[model samples]
Target chain A: METGPIKQKLEQQWQDLSLQLRAIPINPLERKWATIALLIAALFIGIIMIDALVHGINAPSNVETIDSARLHLSEEFAEDNLGVQTDGSGLITVRMVAGRYSFFPKHIDVPAETPVTFRWVSLDVLHGVHIPMTNMSTMIVPGYVAQVTTTFPKPGDYPVLCNEYCGLGHNHMWSNISVIAKEDWAAPVKSAIAGGPENE
Target chain B: MNDAAVRKLALGHLWVAFGAFILACFMGEYQVLERSGLIDALESSSVYFASVSTHGVLMAFVLTTFFIMGFGYYIATTSLKQPLWNQPLAWGGFWVAVAGVVLAAIPLLTGNASVLYTFYPPIQAHVVFYIGATLLIVGSWVWCLIMIVMFSRWKQANPGQPVPLAMFATTANALLWLWTSAGVALEVLFQLIPLALGWIDSIDPGLARTLFAWTLHPIVYFWLIPAYTAFYVFVPKQAGGFLFSDEVARAAFIILVVFGLPIGFHHLYMDPEQAAGWKLLHGFGTFVVSLPTFVTGFTVIASLEIAGRLRGGKGLFGWIGSLPWTNSMVLAVILSLLMLIFGGFGGLVNASYAMNAMVHNTAWVPGHFHLIFAGTTVIMYFAVAYYLWPILLKKPLFSREMALVQLWTWFIGMTILTTPWHILGLLGQPRRISSVVYNNLLTLSWDPYELAMIVGGLVLLGSACLFIYNLAKTQLSPVQDGFVQEIEYAEPLHAVTSLPEYLNDFKLWNKVIAVLMFISFGVPILQFFFIDTFGSSAWGY
Candidate 1:
């Protein structure tokens, strides 16, 4: 079979391969291309970092946990407590729950030109909600809360749709968000014990 | 050069892989049609989701696992010039996987396991589905074990010698799979299976997703390394030139294994389970991983250029035209790389931390993956099959022209299908929906794209059938009296006299993988236990 010659040839190939490996760092063309690739990768990371740190555009990663099975019984996510609320500081927040085929508080109203924090939890399975044409999208995983705070600059009616596959009624799972002018919206009365107006 | 047992074993796996692939193609076409709402009668979400679940499992898991196993077997035998390490154990693994597929199909077809392929809990499938899927993974573990054993045995027998590039890549993939599959294995064994079996009353979807995030990203590389192996070892030779650099190819495989595992949180960017810091960290790694693809593109293109120049083609772009277009391997790489360019761009967008919000869970996600996985990866799979079938069967090809046409149509069809899909994502269409029943002006705008996708699906289905037909004909044709061919790996530009151990082995890389995975995933997974969390009851069929 003349195995000696074949083995010698293979041994030569191995040495040449090692030489090429050594040359990679010193070879002008190879070094240049490697540097360019690294720089491009760094540039991408830089853009992402600037977007997160400077531009305030980051992933919706509010790591808040909740008892999803008892979400409806919770104070913030109670059925009657769902939808738009205004705090003492005049900050608007929308609390909602996503179930098999629908978002609780099926319709919502918020003031335009103001930031609204959406706090969503899933009652069962997993769901994702997105308000079309807006940066208001987050996954509603059971056992945790998904929160996204964004300002709707333009006042209009936007469809709040379930983007994640939930169940048989996934496509049917949607609601509406009406972003009204700030002046047109009325804040609900606070109880007198809470030191606020009692208008019905 | 393969023995009868090895040939039978390889063919068995390939047939199953392609069988699953062709079936999944039909389901893909049905999905686009149903989702489009163009056909009124096909409007059942139950049926649609069921089909989608089966489609994803078949194409992503069954087709890939079986095909990789088959291809690994052939590459191990032919390249290493050794008999398969354990013949009966290999067949045992194959049957275990087949049994799993059959078990899972029961639930998938009857709509009991319509949880989609991700099967994220508390959306539960039948207990049998979890068990079946676990069996499939367990079967692949056998293949992994066999590959590692053969690799070590060869190294021991021929000390200080460089392993064949093909076998080296196969062993790398096998090791990567062992690491890659562990995440899902843990998730299934502890979370999904127990929950489905009613042993656990509540399950944390957060922890499930975190574990899946471990497997999710690297598994793509597990699927892709073989295609890259072909690009490195087979394509250059097929194109009639030497490999640009064998050392560079080894480096690429090593980097892919190391960088690929710890960066899965890019899939979890929009999820609440992981913190922003971890997501950003993984996002950085995601971009870093693209370096190998860039190097691959350069090296492969340079090889093709050399081949073209050798064939007397002149000018900068003339090499592209002078490539052996009739050769299925050459034609497939050309098309595969073209798809990789576009798909890679889409992947970068998905990996972008803030930018992902625009396309997260949208049709764009599917579009990006289909282009990369189905278009780029599977196209290479076609080339490898076309290249291997005649050698395995000792017969001539049924139709070279038909194979070329199939490759072109696959590229064209994939482009047509995915372009509008990406557009639909930008237009704010959520993926995995059975029907678009919104009926608004915005929804109506998606109609033309949907129509285009239907045409694309039809073209892809026909192309798939042609691929199978050519291979089947090749196999069934009577063996030639004097058919003689040997698998040829591309030689490097210069012969080597010696090499370092790091480039020739995976022991160090495996350690590096462990450290990287721990650093990236340790706190994220551990936090589930430390934090106050709730688990949800089972919710779906």
Candidate 2:
């Protein structure tokens, strides 16, 4: 046979080979199984979200814009309002600034059974406060405010660490929170600081 | 096509890729040791950060880009039986990429540029680093352009024939890379380069991060596509079976490229730039992308099962034992899929909006990525290297047994390293730390895991060395007489004489990607420009 004809025959054989490789139709039962798997996953996610919202054990909400450079000057994050602030109604809001290597207001004291709003912003780079043993975490991005409100059920110590890498001192970037009983909590000097809504 | 010339060109690229890979493996071992806080003398934050930056760039950018390009060239030529459209341009692209690697190395090695992998801003690197990165990406873009052109030419010449599965997947990746890299490319050109050059006073980090997020997630898929291509096109044949489904493979690639582009906002779930609604949307898209992976797993496993049964094995799972485990290709896939299962589960957790809080930016993040990228993806790269090394060099592998040992060790080492890493994340150990000096009870609990990681890193380093030695020996060994092997593509169970335009071609899918991207990202990105956002000054050296 001539080279041209032989090459053509081989090409035809290759092309014809596909006929044997056709996909077999999947059983309806398999489709049903797939649907069930998807539904279970969706249901799990739904329950998690509902639980988070109902219990207020989630990322902070109502993020407002902020001047990262002027954070120390901002009324909400002023040195005076740095730690725990309680309004007349005894509701607590924790005001803090997360900078390189440290979270301002190193010791955060929040009253248990009180919905304390944790509002923070990054002075330089991005940081994240992950409260261990709780579902409360939020990013501290520069030029924007991060807010989360949750009430701890009992009084205990919860170590807050910066999850996001900021700089050289990232490993040392951590703070402690001493959650005391609501009955032992003291009143705040600056009531309802930042002049926003007093309570959620 | 000049076969000798193409082989030379492909080998050159692969050598460069493997060279960077071996060097980075050494650096990786040192990193684990230093970070374990066990070696006090090795603990320098600057050195650790610099090593990390270089290691990340070499592995993530250098190794993956070179390997993908080289593999693409070989695939396009061998599968299509056509010459690489522009050989000189391909060589030029290779040189440009090498030069970029060299230029980037200067700062990364000297501790001048220590921005770890991600394009998070304010923590700036040297101007040379950004410029070099641009050049590297630009070179890859040239490869992209060439692949698309070759794909179009092939379709034009052969009117109705189904494109070979390998070539189709390669061309799909080229298209995906083109779409995906534009996000980071724009960021570098406009935001980073200017900031580094002192032209811009500051940058809106939110915008920078949003743009990088566009590239971050899809880039993993870009690295992964070649591995997946091997799974679909080569694994069945090597396992002594036909491909289970060609159409399903094509569909998987289509969903991967189309859905992968617009869903990167999942990476920005914790970031402040994008809203929760957009994150949720991307989160859903992330789940949708997982469908292709499921299809791939089922198809690959079924193909292996068919191979095993045809070899006289019986029962559902017994056929797995009948598989040619000595074959590097077969062994790699089984291990790759095992890693993918764990890695993929970790991905789902990361993609979940609420559940992300538990593991985000923790040790779990690195553990998950290393399993997927190194375990699943790079293991396949090794298989491809082993399979192709002999063909390219026109010699049998120097040591098949060594290759098998290397694969096993790699799989074992990765498990040892990442399992503990995952546990550490759950134990509240954060990632990106140089060391933990002030050891208390909680920090002290991490010691055993850290030691395990050190041992794991050492084993992987040894395996990496073995792989390089084997490839080098194969290339340098004297050619055997009558040693001739032609590339063999796996035939599908049913031959496809014809395919729909969307199935055989990417034109339809490209348009689909454009619309989906606009819907997903257009508003989120434009909102940044419309809103009055403050810019943060560069903070890091």
Candidate 3:
């Protein structure tokens, strides 16, 4: 297993290669290319940073935790308390529960041209809710509450779809949200809140 | 070198990888067809989900782990010109991983563990799935151990010498895996396993996701590095050119491993558990990781440019056409790079902290990964297989024409499959669903894309079959007498007599990774424990 000649040949090849390379003038192309590549990456990061700062298009960061098993028992997410509620300060908050196959308080009514904060909790498995054509999307992890606040300027019926796979019926796990005119929304809210037979 | 033992080991691992791959390809086509709702009898949620889960596991875990392990072993032995450090241990690892895949498959195929590949908790899988996946990681860890040891042994033998670029890249991947797998290993052993076994009455889904995210992103790099290694080590020589720069290739690998970690929070950008600051931080890091890929694209193309010019090419774009396209390795690299450009653009969108909210967990996510992982990464795996089959078996390829067609079809199929997928994401299609039963205008728009995907999937399946058929025929053919061919690694035009220790060794980079990981992940993971968080009881089977 004497490898002296093989090793010598490898060393010779290295020496010859080095000599040949050194004889040729150094190419500044790779160095310039590396710099340009780094700049492109930096440019992307800068744009993202600017977007985050300017548009406030950040992630859902409210790290609020609730017990999944005890969610129904909680004061905020109780069966009777779920759906669109207008607080004293005119803050419209929609509290909903995402369970195995459906979102509780299935049919939701809200007003357009007003800020509505969505507070979402999962009673069982993980589910994600998204309203297409709007900045309303968040994951409803069982133990954590996902909250997103947005204003819908246009009045339309949007499908509240569960994007995350929960179980076999995941595709069917969806509800509907109707965004009505501010003047027209008050009547429906009253009817919707008045012990409407729960969609549970 | 008369290395029959190593050849057998490499061949064994590669066969298993390709085996899982072909099976997954069939499942992939079925999924598209089922999701499209084009056929009535093919609609079963239970079966669809079970198939999706199996397809994901087979492609992501089984195929990648076995392929990287096999490729690593072959690279280590051939590049270093030494036998495997521990042949028996390698065999043991192979069996362990095989057993793990089999054990995991029982639950996955039986519809007991249809949690998708992520296995995010609260939506729990069967306990056997977690245990089996752990064994697979453990088996890969053994391969990692062997690679690192071989690397060190070579370094010791040839003091201050620049290790072979192929071996260096392989060792980098080995180190990267050891660090990368730690996250999922911790999650599985501490959380998923305990919860699955009912030893823990309640588990934090937030914590589970956090830890899984830690493994999720870097694992992509773990898979990609082998492809990048081929791009550097094999492609240039196959294209008939010298490596543009050896030092830069090493630098690219180092940057990938170090920066690839600590950036997993990008995956958690839209989740509630982590804060926007951490996501932004990881987002910046994600962009930083893209630099290596850019550098790789530049270096490899430059190599090809040199190759093309030598073959009498002129004009700015003339080099592209002049390079050898019939050679499988050369053809695969060209196609792989083309996919990488598109996939890398998709990645930029995914990593943009603000833009990510628009596409997170949508049809876009799958579209992005399929382009990158199945498109760019796996195509090179095909190339490497085509290149190695002849050398290891001492038999010429049965059909070079078939290999070229397979490579072209894979690229076209992937493009066709992923393009509409990205479009569907923009149209607000949710991923991982058994079907689109919404029957709305938006959902209706998704139908055309779904139809296109089926066509794409069919093409890909055909291409995959052709790839396997070529390899099988090559291996089954009689070994030619006096057929001797050695593995050829590309030589750098500018080789060095002496190199900085940092470029040649992993000691410093390992420490750097530790510090970076601490900074990026420390608060995100630790916050889970320090906060007043409630755990969720297991829900799904």
Candidate 4:
């Protein structure tokens, strides 16, 4: 009779365990989490896409148009296009002559908060016009000026180098980009008046 | 050649290649140490870049090419049961190629030819360097011709039969090399030579880049095929298993040859020389090439699975454990494939056009490539050398334990070296830099990783030395094992008999590659000629 109870208990336990197993069914939380993970991934990717779109749309659409103007790079700046004048809030196109780069331009002053269009082409071997401070590096290929544009918010002196291995003295090819503050233009104007005609 | 003659012949070539390799290994260790900025004495930007260039050329071009040629001659004669076609020409190719290496070495050693082993134009090297590189490639071309001729004659004699897998793979590589080298050959012969020689005042760099792109991408496969050959022919047998599929192996080789050539624009994705559309198409082609690799992975794994099962291993993945871990050949594959996974992932990043911009011309590129080429590919070369050395020498290996230790060290060293490289690349370290003279917080952060890389390099150098030492001992060992083992290729799951002409021949794929390459590279390359391009005045010498 005691054996009967043991057998009954074992049968009862087996049934209960079976019911528990049946109740366990497929895990809904794991499935839900998987979907959630996938959605989150999709959403993250979407956010990046939208952000890129907004940035692109807000960017000036001028870059879509290639400047077919024949840009040249000589050893030195063509005497006529030596000086760069920016009219406060517009694009300034600087003509670059590509050849053996010699002169280290200590200060290339650009108006503050202005976009400067670099129309630079190599007159000889490949060189990159690198603005090290801003991390703007563009290839200056032979027969073509790889056109690029960037707006500088802060005005400061930035080192520039020919990033491409152009020749023996590639290490020596260094210049400076002088970003002029908007307020500083008046100082230059005052200096022009104070110091005889502005020397070219 | 008789047994003694064969051993002597192979020994001479092997010694030179390994000797160069060991010397380069020391240089490599120094490079990592210098690059890490830990050793002030090792710090010379000129020396570092020069050493990097020489190390790359010696390991990738010189050692591998010479070894492969010597190995090929042995395999060809033994497997084909025929004498080498045009023996004089073969020797001529060898001598000429060696001369070219010497020519290139002068500039590389002196820091005059530091273009980082790339075909970037107007990066003026000494004229001798360019000429030497050209000669080296031409020498390989000669080998290519000989391999093809011997292959054809063998096939003609034994019609309706499958070529031995090793010979078949070798021939495929020869064909691949012949086709792949043309782009760079043309670029070097015309553009670079003239520039270096002061003959051409200026060249359209876009064209030069486009031409170089043609060679840049596929040459990787040229380096890789021998490793793949070992995988198909040796691994299964070594693991005590059969290859999953013979036909699949053939198909993989054929696909690699066909697809690898047309996908050159992937290298130019960031460059302005090619249009975005072409780069995108090439990106797609790059992904297409991945299919064959996946096929190889599946086929290889399945073969191993079968082997494991045959060894009385049970369960799904449990068969992995059943594999012969002690065997050098089997051990190499596991490590090589592990490297392949990471290297292949990095390759995915490179193929992704947007991400490529993030790491373009960065340290990440070299990190990715070294894993694939040096880690995945060269490790296998070591395994093959171990397996072949004894067979070629007719003696037992001096130390199986040492060989295994070398393999392990190699894998560990590779991980240590390349992990930092990828991190550095992502952290915005540029490739081919002479020095990081400027130090800021960001550059300072790179120090620990560089340190790790140097440690890895030291370990790898030791491993390289150990490998050469073992081979030496094997050759000189007084005890000879009377055991005779033929070259055993793994049999695939499905038996192959009377395979279609496609499997037996490359003629169709050759035609197909010709057409695809034209479509992919034609417009991108031809545009420079058609466009009204302006000429740049001279800059370099």
Candidate 5:
């Protein structure tokens, strides 16, 4: 493993390089450029934050604490309120409890062209509800009620998947959003009441 | 200085670091293969997670800690022209950290500590694992103390002089790590240990995550400063030119240590405990931190440009072509910067307040970090090892050609591995999944990417092996003629005879960090104790 000639070549190259470098010199970084870069970066990120605000990105900022242990017994998250509920103003609120490996009320039914608020709480660990192809996703952290409001402009089946890892069956944790016509949403409700919840 | 004593100590650390690195590389390949659902025989969730946890710790904690400590020792001694502040204590820290790693490896390997490296509990691991990890941090704290002490002692001896750039940067990392580790130290000592020992019934995940976030982001800078140190201090000399600007390099280090600490809450943007206001503030801080990275890139590239032009290159970008690509250090910097460009873009996307929704918690997160850590940072570590091994061992590199091949393969393999991983995230593939075996259309879409990742992982595994082999051969080979090399610190184009106190010393910056950390984290963390928050019981062992 001898390279006498190669070693000499490298040494010669080094000397030549030093000589060439000494001939022409340039300063790479200027303090003004650094300041400018920082200012521009701050401004760029600021614009994004403003855009986020405008687009209702942080709509879930309204902080509300919840007793995660007794979520099932709580009035807002009771079994009766586990599905869709429509108010007088025709706005629908979908409440669900997100736990390990499942989002309860696996099927969410809503009406198109109507404002809907998806509110949920994690029973254990951190779970995130990310609906593919839409701007609706919020984290379900235990001891806090997570809320995000949006409207389904068009009727479609949107799969709601838990993007965050929550133990073993995380991959299996997914639900379906059944956004139907406004007229269709009314019929299922009326029929359920008339038939007595169990029969329906 | 007793050069032999220092070299022996440094070599011991490097060996351990590389030993951990090689083992983790094997595990990394296994993880990618297992998660890709490419092989049914390798599909055990418990085993896969155990492997991932060990892999993450060995690479992230053990490898980086040992390597940085070793490099810092050699740099502090040679650059300052002084003996190590304390030799026996350095060896003591080494053994204690080794003991911690051994203790932790038991649980990690046996699947008792299958909780991923993040260890965001509710999902608890064995009590021994937490204790072992705590000891590791405590051991590294010893190194941090030595670095600061050495820096101070050198300054006391030589007043108003610019601490050598290498030592200055090393000391900054020491300060950064001391502050960084405190967050997780508090969490582990008070919350995790008690819960794991069954002394407490439950632990608050929010508080735990808040604390980990403090360590999580800056720990990256801790791993990175060494790589940056190499860029500022080694690359220019290796490229056959002087450093572009010493002052710019100093400022970059100052800003990195200052801004790196408080911006960690961005990791908690999707978590529940912290308010959006705090997350937004942290997000802004995250953006501010990018400035130093840009400064580093500009300074290093300009240094290279000068090197190339001096080597008889022409034009604005012709310097790129003229660079000494055959040199391992020069080649690695080019590849590292290339990776940083993409990785840094991914970082900005992650830092974006709203756009984060698109990529948060998905495969994108892993992809982005892999590109940054393993690609940009680890590749430079390889370069540094190649550059330093001969000097440390008093032997010529066994094979320079092999080193070049390894760097190229690492760059190519990282590209193949992470590109598909990022795409899978965009396709809604979640991270930390053991397998994506569902044969649905969406899951099937990930198949090609998964296959690409397997090929990439295998290539990376081969490259990693080559790197270790080359270093081992270099160290074991008999001493050669012309092999006696001394440490060479890059000189700046413009001489720096003196520097301001703030640049030369970290005392003022330390106070600034304290104030910033308190302002950013004080309320968010204290509120956990102040409020009547419920704790979740242990769900996993």
Candidate 6:
């Protein structure tokens, strides 16, 4: 081929390639359906998530009554004498005075597989009781007792936090919760916060 | 100064904006990773908190405030077909504002102020922090005054002619901001500063929160009105279509400014500062503001439909495809609207008086805000920068393909970052946490989403770098492609050559605002003097 004809042939080939790449047609109905499906899926996913996270998917345990569960939580964490695990496991009691707080048996020597309940009441601003391990949570207000019940599935150290955005030091006000093995709670265990008279 | 000088002025503003944006991008990536808690090296609470605060202030405060003031001056001059009335004062405002940002950055970068952007206190920062922030807002107030004056002067000089749509919207924003910033200005000057400096014995937190609430809701409109102005005035012309309705556009601006006020209590819904009745009144007002959004939506979409129809598309929604997808402005609107739907829905849930309990103070708030502010509003800012910079600089874009890529990545990255954030929020994960120290089921459930966010952040960071690179090249390119394009505004469909004094005016709007503020806030605010209420003890000092 002559030089001019060769240049024309290359130009024609590039045009064919451009047309092929740019000509991919999109279907309208398919696109609409895809958007609709994605939206519906997002909605369903949101519902399932909230159902699992907030309202929760699993039903509240097969325990007989809410009243009974409240009682267990209330007695275990009261500031007065509380129901201890008879297996020599210590009990914890918490009280709020004005805006200050004091705890009885702040560090509990609780046995493994034993369920501990927190009975909390706020004297001032609203407070939330949250234990992240077992997802146990409740809210406490002035004169209104709120309780949370959870079993220590493992012997480890965990923090119990006040999740509410209360005044200040909200982050620093958390306390420690230690889970002891069944054998340790049966005997005497060293406590982080000793049950001393001066602490009161 | 000549037109060349004005062009240089506009270019400088855009250059600073892109510079701040790229720094913000890297900070964003670092944040997502630090918050994720997967990598030990990237985990530093001090750095994370400081970075988050600085990133938010830069993007939300510095970037938007400076960009808006600069663009407003230019738009006011060009759209009204006049020179800036007070150039020296405008430049003075610029310097003062820039100085404030530098002062604020000293404490922020050094970790003296880690108030995590929102600065809702009891959480005290250095006194210089509060002072710096005050100066920034004060500088903007000067710009706002200048704008309102220019609008008034323009109307005086050229009466009976329809003042351009762009100038009208800019003036509306200036007036809206004047009313809007006063709330926070009073709060900061009176309460926050005194509290931070130990001058006040006890701050009335209820009043402070209420004042902040007054400024809270409408600030979004301050960011949004500019974006909407571009949508109505610039995008239509760029898409090769006429504006659907000039009157409807003006009505939307009026409604946004008027109803945008008196709806501040939605932020106070959870606070005891405002009573239930007042909050409800504000709640109802919040719902009313959504009406103008719908009005804008219909008008803009209807305008797009006309463009599509004229371009030979048939059917109701078929016109969506007929839109000029290759055009950056049109593409940006499509993406912006997509984000608005998701973010707006999140806002609906947030605004739902009853449902607010579900996600209150959760990660959802940040997620919703980031999507709306960053994805929806800032992306449109990008579109504006792209459109304006070329004309203002008298140079062709260095890379159109790169701009499109950057915009797409930004949208995708925002979705990735925020979707997980909202889910985590709903799952009971709190916001403003430096890290998750516990290895528990609930915290563990957040791991996957946090990882996604980190990845998304990286993508966004890369995209940000690309954006700055493109703009930099366009400005400093060796190839001098001389392209001089004057600003072309969208013409109203009905061709409103002449307008009534009331229709093409803010004089009536100003009077209406005076009466509205008196009726809505007069008694409620005055009640503080008469009522016997306890105040909060000085907790900050």
How high is each candidate's TM-score?
0.95, 0.93, 0.95, 0.81, 0.93, 0.77
Best-fitting candidate, scored by DockQ: 1
lDDT of 5 at B506: 91
RMSD of 4: 13.2
Model 6 - which docking category?
Answer: incorrect
Give the interface RMSD of each candidate.
Answer: 1.7, 3.2, 2.8, 8.9, 4.3, 12.4
TM-score of model 4 vs. true structure: 0.81
Model 5: per-residue Cα lDDT over A88-167, one tens digit each:
77667788888877787777778887778888888887778877556577777777788778777778877778876677
Q: How close to the true structure is residue B189 of candidate 2, measured as C-alpha lDDT?
A: 95
| lDDT per residue (tens digit) for residues B1-541 in model 4 | 5544544555666666787789789988888777666768876767777787798888878887877777677767776778778777877887888888899999989888876577456557788999999999888788888889989999999999878777888899999998888998888888888877888776666778788889888889988888888888789888998886776678779888998999998776545556656775676677767766766666677778888999988998889999999999999999999999999989877775555555665678889998998899988888888888877776778999999999999999999999999998776665555455442345676678878888889989989999989998887778665766455566655565566566777887788899998899888777777766654433333
Order of the predicted models by lDDT, top scorer first: 3, 1, 5, 2, 4, 6
Ranked by DockQ, the better of candidates 3 and 6 is 3
When sorted by DockQ, best at the front, the candidate numbers are 1, 3, 2, 5, 4, 6
User: Per-residue lDDT tens digits of candidate 5, residues B1-541?
Assistant: 3999999989999999999999999999998888877778988887888898899999999999999999999999999999998899999999999999998999999999987788868778899999899888888989999999999899999988889999999999999999999999998999889999999988877788899999999999999999999999999999999899888798889999999999997787766678888888888889889999999998998899889999999987898898999999999999999999999999988888777877778888999999999999999999999998998999988999999999999999999999999999888787877887433456768889998999899999999999999999988887787768888989998998876576688987899999999999999989887877878888773
Clashing pairs in 6: none
The candidate 1 chain B region of ten consecutive residues with least summed lDDT is: B493-502
List model 3 lDDT by residue over A1-200, tens digit each: 57999999989967875674464433589779878988999898888888788887677888888888897789999887888888766788889999878888888888999888999999888899888777788888888889888889999988888999899999999888889998887733545655677554
lDDT of 2 by residue, B1-541 (tens): 3898999989999999999999999999999999987768998988988888889999999999999999999999999999989899999999999989999999999998888878568888888999898889988998999999999999999998999999999999999999999999989999999998899998888888888988988899999999999999999999999888888788889989999999998777766667766776777778778878877887898889889998878886889889999999999999999999999999888877778877877788999999999999999999999999989988999999999999999999999999999988887777888887533356777889999999899989999999999999999899898898878899988787778666898876888899999998998889877877888888884
DockQ for all candidate structures vs. native: 0.49, 0.24, 0.42, 0.08, 0.20, 0.03
Q: Which stretches of candidate 1 lie over 4 Å from their true place?
A: A1-27, A182-200
Which consecutive 10 residues in model 2 chain A have the weakest lDDT in total?
Answer: A191-200
Candidate 3's C-alpha runs over 4 A off are: A1-27, A181-184, A187-194, A198-200
Clashes of each: 11, 14, 0, 15, 0, 0
Interface RMSD of 1: 1.7
